[model samples]
Target: MSKPLRALDEAALVLFSGGQDSATCLAWALARFGRVETLGFDYGQRHAVELDCRETLREGLRKQNPLWKERLGMDHTLALGALGDISETALTRNAEITMEKDGLPNTFVPGRNIIFLTFAAALAARRGIRHIVTGVCETDYSGYPDCRDDTIKAVQVALNLGMDSRYVLHTPLMWIDKAETWKLAEELGGPALVSLINQESHTCYLGDRGTMHPWGHGCGECPACALRRAGWEEYVAEKARA
Candidate 1:
């Protein structure tokens, strides 16, 4: 069994994407870590609008709490936009999202989590930060192999061996499904978190924020929307029963 969550009381760098999971992880880091920073990637996703949302949410979270302004340090949006030029995935291009023979979805960007975690580890090492937080959950992921716990552990070992430094990668949502994720958000920030997630965070693949679904706002057709909708329904039903 995986270990339970603990207050690490150390500086952390969160691999934030301005989505529900990342936002929740950021909130979790802020509550548990002594200091925190966020790193966002502009990998030229089809929904680059999420980048704008990241900045907006960062500011909004800061404004919501005085401690956030002081403890939430520099948030960086790195320019990996060149990934779009070289990669032709559904997330960065207009293409049909179908499953491959290998059982991975067309939306899966190969090595995305690996690249993100590598860069996060490097940045954290430079800043003397030991903990790197990410919201990669295998339980609710849409068949993204990179989001698996074993993949994360392999990358962690490779990073430590390559850099000769000890870095702890924190995956608070690894074992939890989406309903548990919603519960976690509420536990960390109460109803305000629910509002922020529903109103601000971007999870849609098509970049359609105008449409509303039971989960949140999205195109309502993508795999992401499907998982989110199911999770929200389950969470709400559980609450109603309680």
Candidate 2:
């Protein structure tokens, strides 16, 4: 992400989930690309609050800057209820979130990212876009195999060859930690953007919007909440030091 942005003619579609990570990625795309469209998945996640939060985050992001307002494009949502119908994980089911003996969390929904990228690539092809942005990161994550950088690289190659499209999947947050992600939002759009994410984006696996934490709203115990909380705290601490 240290490199300069490509020309404005290069359009991008974002894999937006209306969660903190995805929202940040959306902002990243808007800041760099000329036309940015968002695509979300309704894979029957228990935390369906994210689906409801998408429009709010999108609207807020577009308004944060005039350029963002101009670049933000159409939004799309696909219903992948089959992924949930087959996924018995905590995210897709009402089961309690827990760690598996094999070191991966129960929240890991196999092939979810792959399916998302495949569908996103198809959508991008239809829209004549060449770049796709996603928020998947291994620096601060739940040990999902699909979120790894190598996995995304492999997926990108597979996508381009299978579809015969020269689509470049962008992963700006792949090497950055959560603390850096918070800083990235500020660097892209300042405090207003940070506030928008804190108030609009949904990340709790439990879908507990009723309970509000300093970082955001969540049960504060789930892995997602814990990671976000820790990151926010570290980011705030670094800001104070500066």
Which candidate number would show the highest lDDT if scored against the true structure?
2
Q: Write the per-residue lDDT of candidate 2 for residues 107-213, one digit (tens) a residue.
A: 99999999999999999989999899999999999899999999999999999999998889899899999999999999988999999999889999999999877
By TM-score, how accurate is candidate 1?
A: 0.94
Candidate 1 structure lDDT: 0.86
**How does each model score on lDDT?**
0.86, 0.92
What lDDT score goes with residue 203 in model 1? Answer: 90
RMSD of 1: 1.8
Which segments of model 2 are wrong by more than 4 Å?
Answer: none
